[model samples]
Target chain A: MYKYNDFDEAFVRERVAQFRGQVERRIDGSLTEDEFKPLRLMNGLYLQLHAYMLRVAVPYGTLNSKQMDMLAHLAETYDKGYGHFTTRQNIQYNWPELRDVPDMLSDLADVEMHAIQTSGNTIRNVTADHFAGAAADEVADPRPVAELLRQWSTDHPEFQFLPRKFKLAVTGAAADRAVIKAHDIGIRILERDGVRGYEILVGGGLGRTPMIGKVLHDFLPEADLLPFIEATVSVWNRLGRRDNKYKARIKITVHEHGIEEIRRLVDERFAEIRPTFNGVDQEVLREIEAQFAAPEFRTDGVDDYDIAYADNPLFRSWADTNLSEHRADGYAIVSISIKKHGATPGDATADQMRVMADLARKYGHDELRISHEQNVILPHVHKSDLPALYLALRAADLATANIGLASDIIACPGMDYCALATARSIPVAQEIATRFDELKIEHDIGALKIKISGCINACGHHHVGHIGILGLDRAGVENYQITLGGDHTETAAVGERAGPGFSADDIVPAIERLVLGYMDLRDSADETFIETYRRLGAVPFKDILYPKEAANAA
Target chain B: MARAFTPKVITSNLLLSGDAVWFTANDTWSGDIAEAEFLTDEAHAELRLLEANAQTGVMVGAYLADAKLGDAGPVPTHFREDFRTRGPSNYAHGKQVETNV
Candidate 1:
């Protein structure tokens, strides 16, 4: 929703031109692959397994109808008629040719979007809660501060080359939909004595070494947000190890030097840099806050919605699963499911993108959000308009009402597209979702988060899933290791591994057994899989996952 | 004793299209894995890989991948290399679409 000013537009256009030149040089033999690889990565272009992949930033997962249309156009014109929305709230075009990327970027710049900082060692796209403005429990819209941070970090000279990639997330609600605990810096907007402030956490990350952030500042004043964040990153930038790529992330740095020492260092750095910020950041934040103002709501009865919910089982099931509580009266947040059973998680065809864009324009107050769970959000749909919206989604095959269920999985493009993946993730995710749907008990299972990663990079946030499936190559065979009871919420904790791995063929049945076993183990229907796991611990679940071993022991 | 040397083929992704390509016996890049020059000796594989890496303007990320001689030609020995030749399992968009494999 933050419109690009003249300066922002100029900067983006200039970067596109610069990249265009770099691409030309690379093709013409002036620059070698080694020289051009980093430049291409900085522009969010990667030489993936099958083709060039372009990652376009959807800042804080916010999009207008026009921008959505632009993404559809890019998919139709430059890519293979579909785009994969990633866990970082960015969209990646998987098959763009090397020569067509500059034009693709130029097209993106026209829509106030670019792929800048989507990759590389710079601060990546700063994600926030998908329900930032519409969530009923939010204390404030976190996007204003998120936008301010975007402005501050984009092309910042001091942070151009950190030890490794840095990620930041913000959430205004206590529910923690943004998974803030697993970021390098996680900011929670808080209010005390009717004055707004922040609670800052640092050194959280999910990779080979997963960590939940430690509280660096229990409460930081609203005015000191920028300076304090800069101080924290600056301290890490100086002290973070460069000897090994695996040991370079801030989590390892924090682990090596305890949180207290890191806190002390951050405090010392904050003292040095706190005076440098002269309150201009606050002014910019206020301007951004105005742009995020709530849309005009219609104070009308929802008689049609009520009738549809009562009469049609299909509509009722969809409405029950897909809708979330809105902050405004008579409005509901609609989460459009991109993970239809047997489809690639997070992929939306060009036609589907256009349909979502049209829906946003016609009924969703021109606002759309890409959730980190690989779903799309119509943040401000009126209750009166729900029936029509649902009908449109149903026509597009987007009405798979399995949000927060076992069928609603978050998966990375593992060996399927990624050059670094050790095994395939998408097929595993597909099989699991399809199997669950066939079982017809996803709704019964209730509020399960199944996240799969191709490798240890944790791009799918598998470490935080209620049921995490990690794919790996074991002696050249595809193997999946399961982790149980991970929570991505405020009480975030890494899942515990359930024992030995399963072959690709056995994985789906293994998951089915685990879920079915939970059904028997749960005290009541109200007890979710995660709640039961927490109550009984991983022993029972491990038995369920490794049934052969358990049977042999018995 | 050292493990027996596995036969290998030099592979890279084409610069323009970013599709998987293998060094053929004819000293040119081919998208089809069957057309690759399968090297049985370790010294030959290393030399071929180095030669393939030098074609920077044509491709990127050249490396040696395990292969075994098939009835037609060289075939991938690992699943990753097989996926590279055939494309992703979920879709028919990559080499599958082009080569009709």
Candidate 2:
């Protein structure tokens, strides 16, 4: 966990004070609703369906026990004893009185957290691999860079009011847990020929228009990162479309201008800003890096791991799914499944928060992370403590043992809460997860991600799910559109839309039919939903979903 | 369809020494409750807002009331609107941390 410096402390305090005054002025007739809306938005507040929703930034989804406790307190005291952990890894309090928000901000500041840029059109929270430091195969920790970006972007005068909200993500591992490819700027920490650097991927985003990022620079030297990023943002800032909100994101800019042109501009800007670095940025990065230095590992032998795996079927099953290859030899990166069967994905109660906090403090090395897939990670759990940790998690109902499986769906809080949502997403996700679990088909399916978005904002990353469900509001009726073969990985691609949108009543059944179609079409049991879908294409699945002869034939 | 006009907290900003008490209600604070103007036309909305502001006084939460102070005059933490407006205070329970002071 990175502790806040004096700068962070003062910044949060000042922001809280500033927002407090703004609230007062609004009350005093000095500010109109329009005037106050943006001000509140800048602080990560939104006026949702029934009440005001306050989204607190989790800062790349890293939190310590103390911060988790504070969140628990807020949920219990201010909210309805539960917090919705979003796909961006931020925690949202669905019901907070507008008046109580300032206090909420103040409480967050006390924990070295604030909700600035969790909303509004500016750069939102910088996300990264939840298993950053502890990943078995990572080149280096990505958080230091994520943190650096965090500090640089926080209240950056130039980018405060961009054309639309910008997003950035980073990953240390070759495996893409952070969904880096779906962000405006994705940085992968890399080392080539003895020197460390970053692989910069730019102009990738998901919304109404989804795109896979192009590699802007193969390997940018570590020192030139800030300048490189600054250049990219500046180029997009000046040239990005402002006429239409939908076309304003860097994705559209990259698309319209082409990757080579964007790269050339970014390089030009980087060169211009290179001389001004003054080594201070590097020093800051070095300082942050020291904070992320790998934890001490005991050299004790753990020869029993294989034997335990062979003996225990449940542990073997859990290891098969929940564990990731660690950068270390004896340890494994653990992604604890928060999405239990039939439950809303990415939601954890106050008690669950506490248990996770305790687990992070105890079995894990006080290192915890929230994945973009809406799961928690005990990144560097020792192979020896796995059984005990598993037991504890089972007791707490946090142990689902399904990480990338079908039941572990990524679902957004849809029409149930979001004012912008056209139809319900959560129930559809729930029913699908439940259906698969009841059929006991989850394990056989293997490594399928089903993501649901309430709307085209694509908050759930529905655009990149193996199975994507998009909810739409059709004349006061709820409808769902399905897309297939989208993946959120190294080979990221937005799913192709299935034929016609289904009614709310028809969606879950349609999904079941689609899955059955995939099962039948799969080459072998090893073929995942995505692999099968890619090989078969959407035609067969479309036929299954729209079974009527004319519709199927089309 | 009948839409009831309740004093909606349109905008909330914490001001002064970090007091979170005030929020705009019908373009003016009314201690979290203001008699709203029913709008059939633009003029009625404007008049109702003006009258409400006049009746409720300045955008002050309950703690700002002179009578509520009793022996202790004006404690920032003591105001509910202060809590609502400013958010939580330095004192844990919205109690005056130093009552003697």
Candidate 3:
């Protein structure tokens, strides 16, 4: 992780002080709610349904044990004894008092963390692939460039208030784990002829309007990354729709003005803005890159891991679901499941944070990453350490053998906590997971992703789920609309809606019907739900979801 | 022509406590929805929402929630508003844990 320099330290301290003053003014009747609301939102504070939610940035979702401990400390001190890691790779504290937020910001500053640009119509926290450096398929470690962009975008004067909230994601690997296609600006680290650069994609996002990003540049030189990104967002900030809140995302702008025009505008703006950077950002990038240097790995390991996998079925099941191939030999990337059978997705208690922190320090080389799927990743763990790490995780109730499985669903806090939600999402997700768990067929069902969103904001990324469940309020009744074949990978496609909405009571049964139907429709067990959907299309799933309509169609 | 108002209650999240609060007839915020003042008139609901919104030091995000008059007072008409009174269904926290005297 990039340690904060004196400038970084001073800037955050001053910002925290300024916010403290603002909070003080609001408390003393000197400032009205109307006056203080935007200021609060600018600092990642939201007046949610029941409380003021403070979303703290976990830059590119990378954190050391010290930083993780600080998050645990904040959870214990200022708010509840828990933090909710969001899909954007940030953690949100749902119950912090207004008077204590300034202090909380100062506490975060002490750990080189702040909530700036995590909310409002600004470029939100820049996220990257969780397994950036450690994945076997990575072309380069992306965090350094991500860190550089973080520095460049933090309170960039031109983009403080854009047409809407903008998001950026970077992926270093060939596999699109970060859902880069669904971001405002998605950068992929690429290499050609011994030189590294980025494949820039723009106008990708999901909300009311979902779009797979258009390739803006086949290969943008490494030096041009910062200014080019600035040029792109600047163009968007200027011309994006401000008339309607729903159509404000850059996706709509790109849809309206075509990517060729956007490319022309960005090129023109890039020419103007390129000079101001003057290689200063690249100079900072070199400094940031050194901090992200890959950890030293030993060549000899795996005796204990082999024995554990052979001897312990429970350990074997978890390892099968939760472990991924690491770039380092004899090392494995461990993903700790937050979606335990029927628990709330993305929530980790203070004790759980401490446990993950302790594991990261002991075996993970003091490195941890929060995945966009709302799970924690220990990027580098020796194969020998797997048995011990798995044991610790199991004891903490974090080891659920359901990573990328049907039960490991992503859900947003819907009407439960959010003020904007039309219907409840968490309960729906819980019901689905519980139903799947009771059936004990999640592993048999194979790699299926079920993402649930409260409404159209797509916070839970329901648009990209294999089975996307969208909760809507239909004339005072909670209704769920299912979508089939939504893929979040490199071959990203928005899921097609199955049929008319199902009532809250009927949703789980509807999903069960669809999955059971998929079992018969699939050509082979090797065919995944998405692959089958690709082969057979949405008809099979739709037939199961709405039997009466399918009967009429037949 | 203006549309007629449905029954509504002025609601907000308390500043200090961060708990859901309803505007009462006595010009005070109450945690219980049963103590809320149901307004059937459009102008009166708007006036009450404004009054609640003006309590900057006490409340945040003051708005109107649909409610209906019960034998006691007002009750949430929509499930979403009903959920506000009983915290989240995930776990028994916030209003779910609290007991009234």
Best by TM-score: 1
Candidates, ranked, lDDT: 1, 3, 2
Candidate 3 fnat reads 0.79
Write the residue-wise lDDT of candidate 3 on B15-94 in tens digits.
77678888888879898999988888898888888887777777777788888888899999999889888888887877
Interface RMSD of structure candidate 3 (Å): 1.2
Off by over 4 Å in 3: B99-101
Output the lDDT of residue A463, model 1.
96
Error of 2 at B98 (Å): 37
- For model 2, how does the per-residue alpha-carbon lDDT over B1-101 read when each residue is reduced to its tens digit? 86643222222222222222322323443222222112334445445445543433232212211112223222222122233422222112221331210
DockQ of model 2 vs. true complex: 0.03
* Model 2 C-alpha lDDT per residue in residues A30-100, reported as the tens digit of each score: 87656887998999887653347889998888887778888888888887677888899898987677668
Q: Model 1: per-residue lDDT, tens digit, B35-73?
A: 999899998888888888888999999999999989999
Candidate 1 reference-contact recovery: 0.92
DockQ of each: 0.90, 0.03, 0.77
Worst 10 residues of 2 chain A by lDDT: A297-306
Two-way DockQ contest, 2 vs 3, winner: 3
Across residues A145-172, which tens digit of lDDT does each residue of candidate 3 receive? 8898898889889888799998999998
